[model samples]
Target: MELDDLVEELRARADSARVSQERLGSLLDAVIAVSSDLELAEVLRRIVVAACELVDATYGALGVLGPSGEELVEFVTHGITEEQRAAIGPLPRGHGLLGMVIASPRAQRVPNIGQHPDSYGFPPNHPPMTSFLGAPVRIRDQVFGNLYLTDKRSAPEFSGDDEAVLSALAAAAGVAIENARLYEHSRTQQLWGEVLGDATQALLEGAAQEVVLADVTDAVCRLARADACFVALRQGSDVVVAAASGEGDPAEAPGEVLREPRIRAAMLGPAHIEPGAEGGTRAMLPLALGESPLGVLVAEWAREEPTDHVPHLELLGRSLAVSLGAASARTDRARSELLEDRDRIARDMHDNVIQRLFATGMSLQSAAPMSTPEVRAKLDRAVDELDAAISDIRHTIFALHRVPGGRPLSAEIATVCGDAAVTLGFSPELRMTGPLADVPEDVAAELLAVVREALSNAARHAAASMVNVVVEVADDVSVVVTDDGRGLPEGVSRSGLGNLARRAEGRGGSFSVEPGDGAGTRVHWRVPLASGDGPGT
Candidate 1:
């Protein structure tokens, strides 16, 4: 061998050695870059970018497998603009070449993607691609997803060295991904604990129910990373949205009844997930106390992927249920105390005060005969005044003895009217006559619902300047709501009107809506008190 030839061979070997060392160093740097981020989303993105940099690929993506391991639930892409992504349409679900990698869980190198037998072709707006490389990413012995690279920048096709580097990068990515998931889970649990504790604490401290409910919705929306969060509570036979927090208006707003049948049905079931009507995912957390469903906590996300906050949401719902039970118990205890006090006061008035007034009036009558004409007239007038006072006291005693089961009917009517005032821009004229306190508990509940629905209709649909609500209980209980607004429209939809009719019919009552005396509309609901049972028997 010649001396010159030997030196030339040594220099070539040195250059090859230097290239290998640089490649190894670059691979190490890529590994470190991916591991740096603890955020699961950010970590997935970095892994894709690092893989592309290591292999000099123009486009790269990491597809996270769904639970079934047959389809991709998340696709993290790099080197693709948002506009291009929009144009690409819906994401690919493990098919053709992609499915081949998912099924085989092995490295794939395709010189021309279109020429490959398993190629399924790209969507309409996808960028041109000829070469493709893919490798499985595994956590422990289980395949988590696939790493895909295409359009190798330095060469027409990726070399064997590129494939080897990507495989190694994917392995490291699995570890980073697992670590990020753990971190996120830990953070989520911690956040959930804090939110639950705060909500429970708020209730224990005697915070108003509305204030605490609002806080819970806000926290759930933020902690669950949901697009919206709301609580629906059972009110009478219907369900109402009690609190809501998020962007735009929720499907059901506070004070509004829930109209979705599916959600209503899910209220009786355990915690579960379902697809949203338009798109995305919905987590339903049923709030129940033993067998009775108190309500449901609904959290929605704009992404189709399943949420990881289901368990947390369930726990929160249970906490809310317990609080609800406590609140109900407190209310019951307060009502019992109030009723007891009222009973005692009535007994005192009837047993002593009324008796004394009756005796005094009788004495005045007896003395009237012995006085002079002028004195007799004065004594008779005084006796008559005493009789009026005794009669008034007797009526008061009767009212004190009457009980309307749950919340008082008058208080509920006032509340409903007050809430409507916010929307109506003015308060409704409320005239409740007769013995409203003597109405059966079930009948009172139905009557209050009628008043609420009527006021709600007037506030929302009627352009009324004045509204009047009159409730009278005689032989029959009657409710008349009148609004001085534009008369009912021709061919008006009957859905809401039908609900009113159904409620009345459920109580063996009659409901009617007609034109007012001159302008606006009038609603009348009447039920026979002695005809039969009241509401929910």
Candidate 2:
């Protein structure tokens, strides 16, 4: 109550007030420093560091809750080295006192964290901690995360003043975090737009589908910070990697991932992220436009990596599917136009060219009968040439009328047999095996020629019914034509068979004709599925 004691008390209180003001000013500067950066990760790091310094705590961390609200998806820390982090193993999952703070969304101060009833002991190699202070960071009404400080250096425990300062820093941190997140979201949108725009422009410019797909994969991998990215297309009952970007074998990881029933189900359903091999994660996005399922897009990254961009990746996949649909439509339109042109040309040849040539041949034939011997010979030659021209025109018309898109080998064989049936009076039974529809065009063409020649011989020379044709396509392609005829005639020229054999030899294959099982003839032909040496070699 004395005047001197009163003066001393007021002076001490004034000193404390001045210190508080300085601390508040420093906190404001720290908030500005953190908010100045538009990057979400850098903002989070600065917040944690500033929080630790503001409260003079030995360790500080910011744990960002996942969408589920019970788990920490990201944990940024200050005062923990990389070695210490590795030694500490995985980050906490918002359990114990951390969960209390998250569940309550209020500031908490504890003298000894280990003595708390809900305390979950630290993991192996974690540093000792006794005092604890935590405050929830909220963006608007939603709790974004919690700022935690432990082991105050200057006091036995965190006082009310320390809690108040931490709470203020956490509030400022919330605003900074929201701003950084918005900036990051905008940056991500811009990046995705550039990627999709580039891919769309490339496709519209007539780039090959493979090249466009590669560019897309590359862009996605870079954006996601992924170790690899790949697109798998449905092939028969399975999926195969169509495009890939990164190191290691792209097919190996994606092939395994595609086999999972969950991932397979997602190919026609929704996009999802799942754990992958070797401590990694995979984000799968179905590449589809409406009801048409194109395939799936897969991106792989380390398990610890952030997956905030998964939704963007799915969006990219949808954009790519649209591009694919557009490209396919363009190709179909071009094919239809080419088919129409071919049909028009065939009609003209049949309706006009053939008739004119026929008239010319007839005139030449009539003149041959009325001319002298030398002149008659010349007229006969002219008539023969005109007749040959007419025959060639008719064959050209038949080719034009054949189905476009290169009919399947089985279908082409059936047509050849049907035409031969008109001459032989019976249809040949046909059998095929081993991916005949996937045969290369050049190889298929040669096989078709061989089949036609064999069938022609059967109709003209065999002179019997019950013909059988078997076509097998494996690593090697082979065809067998058999007929229940009297057998090879004696003293046959063999020149036609010689030509067929030479055709096979030129392509590293073989052709042979011999007597059939009982009273018929068998023509055997074989060729390598890919051009190279003969089978034995």
Candidate 3:
């Protein structure tokens, strides 16, 4: 041991110590950078970027494991162009070298990625890489995911120092991930409360059921960060979409039947999560009360992630179901009371007012025979006026008894035709057959509109001495209105006729106007009872 050699050794030792201190400072900076954001997605992304910078790697990625811990559910990458990614196609699924790190849960360094025996090789159009560095990120004792780096820039291959730094950064990532997740959960809960409160208040205030339901779906879509959401309610033996929100069109949903087995199963049983198109995820939550299955709430995400919020959504849907039941009961009770009050009024008008008017008319008629010729004529006219008044009262009573909300389909059709008689100078003959009560609400509504339009057209244009309206309900609903005045006129605007056709077509049905038995016009409209049924031409 010469003194000169000893001095040189000490100098080299000092340089090594300085380099270690600088690397330690860089590692601290990287940890702070990854922990700064409270957003889970941003945190995951920053962890990957920071790891790449710390190891001087040209490319980096973070692969979060799925629930089964056998595959990657999420892959966040950096240093790759969007075009390059698209060309590379589907993301890695923890195979070969990636799987080795996932299985070992320890730091790995390889001088040549392709030369390794476990290499799965790169996907087509994937950028070339020769070196790799990987580490496992753990939250407490559980391995959350794995981090991989390739093509180290500062050296031929990743050194032990680079591995040590990446391992440390991965540890800090675990803590950041746990914090971000807590924040996300808290935010989700707050949003859930907001949506529930709004829905309950709307129901309590007697908002329309459709309006409240739409609000619920919109709020849920935002809360779940979903691409689309909808609520499907059971209508008799059929399931119809009541409300929809998010990226899809809302108009296409309402009244449309849900035929998917997965959605139908959710309505009868518990919640379910299934794979979606283009690597997305779908969650179906059953909305029920006690033994009654009311509906289902479905949400879709464009990309499946490791985080799950199905339990929260299920709770929200269940609570909404209870609220809906309460609202429905309240509406029914109020309607019942109104109908009772109306019935009482109708009874009073018929019993007291009509009886008095009838008695007055009879007395006037009896007095007519006892008066002089002029006085007799005046008394007879007075009796006739009283009879007309009684007739008016009877019509009023009929209307009062048949309230708007509680009126049956048959009553509605009869009432419309009866009202049209005033304009037509004669009542249009109306005949209805089949289970009118079993028609779905939407179909019934469309049918009523068709009746009104047909009657109006007959009164205005047909100039017919006779008009007949026939409605039949079975596998489908059909409405046929005929007039005996004139056939389809030449060059007449078909806007009103077009409207009828559109309505029928919208419901998978058809409408047409043709010559009747003689010189008259026949307007025929037919629609299916349920969605997805073939057009009832």
Candidate 4:
């Protein structure tokens, strides 16, 4: 060959080498893009597609390790027909050739898998590969998945350059997969938290168990990405499904949970199961509050195991249990209070308004015969009006009965002050001090009575514009009721509080009334935060 011809051939080879370098750079760029992607499925698909392109291979598949990392599942793939996939019957539960890369957890290149003694031939009618390369996608020490590229167009061995580029791409893929998972988890946790909050609020809004529980289960499903969730309460020895949320038949999820001994034990403790005979993951956790186990919230994730969202699922699992426990306790307490309030209302109606109406009806009846037609008609009409009044009272009582009891004296006083502000056409300033959660009944009663009388006096006699009740608790708790009212009524004598003072002194506390600065009056009292240890004065 001539020197000029030889030089031209050498230059041509150099140009070809530069083109390969440029292609490798593009491949790395694609890999970086995959790592930065915010969705796991998208990242996985991108990785597979990039892999096929980088190695000049015809097809690629990405297999993410399942929940336990015991098995690799074909989670995402490229260059595969949907019909072919369906015919293959679910993503391969990685075994044989697939298991080699997973077990070794590094890049492996095979010139001809068919020639190998360890080769497991493809299933009949399955896609065949003349050349293959598998690289484990590692994020730190954890293997997220394996990327497989197969059947180069030239049917040649995978080059050393292909190994170097794919290995780097797999590392990048890790960053992307983990990044997407982090973003998705944050979004999911926030979404689930809002759901739980709304469910709690919906329960507080007061509704049937069916309605309230339905809201809770729905919220859990969306948050945890569960296939379904069922809410059940233990009724006698049996558990009844009050509400359910999920996809498909939910197997036994749609019905009362099987109370097999294994199930009962599992329910007593948290148990996460592989999903279905069909395949998936399910977890059941007891809703325990204090010593009593309330019930259970059961969740099923459709995959045999959680992929990148195990922590999110676990978070939701614990949250679901807490919500159920709290909601159930509220439900039970409300139920008990309902009965108590009904009895109280019934007694009040019998002893007060109902008896009064009955006596009034009898009086009108007695007067009926002695009167003329017009007079008898008037008396009869009075009886009818009285009967209607009785019905109105009964209705009010029924509504009030649901509340279970009058608000605690302290609560009532606070409400009265605030409610009367609007009615009295002013915004009342109210401040509370000390522990309100567990106030003593008798002390609350006496303090409220003092404040109530002061307010009533201010409205009636004092014609006062403002009232202030300051509750102070120490060794003794006190309510200082002050009013910018006209001084004590003439001839009404300040002796009205003689019994109140006795009650206060009897409890080793003090109650007194004194003139406020300028013209109003101030009544102050004290009682103990703890009782029965005070010295008698």
Q: Is candidate 2 or candidate 3 better by lDDT?
A: 3
Best by TM-score: 2
| Candidate 4 residue-wise lDDT, 148-224, digit = tens | 88888755878888898899888888888888888877887788677667666765555565777787777767656
Least lDDT summed over 10 consecutive residues: which range in candidate 2? 248-257
TM-scores for the candidates: 0.63, 0.71, 0.68, 0.58
For all candidates in order, the CA lDDT equals 0.84, 0.81, 0.84, 0.69
What CA root-mean-square deviation does each model show from the true structure? 15.5, 6.1, 11.3, 19.0
Candidate 2 segments whose C-alpha is farther than 4 A from its true place: 1-17, 87-100, 110-132, 151-159, 193-206, 214-230, 235-239, 244-322, 348-361, 370-404, 413-438, 446-505, 508-537
lDDT of 2 by residue, 1-537 (tens): 699999999999999999999898988888888888988899999999899988899999999999878889899999889999998898898899999998899999999999999899899999999999999999988899999999999998999988888888888889998989888889989999999998888877778877788888888778878888888777667866777887635444433435757556767988888887788888889988898788888888866454687878978989988987887787778777877888999889978998888888788887887889999878776765665465446445545545546456788778878887887898888899899876766667667766776776777678888889999998888999999998767744455556557767877888999999978899998888886543221
Per-residue alpha-carbon lDDT of candidate 1 for residues 1-537, written as tens digits (9 for 90 to 100): 699999999999999899889889999999999999899999999999999999999999999999899999889999999999999999999998899999999999999999999999999999999899999999999899999999999899999999999999999999999999999999988988888788777776677777888889999778777888888899878989888898625556888888788778778998999987478888888889999998898888887454567878889989889988887777678779878999999999989998999899789889988999899888877765665565456545545644645556777778778978998999999999898777776666567667766776677567899999999989899999999998666643445456557767877889998889888889999988754653432
Clashing pairs in 3: none
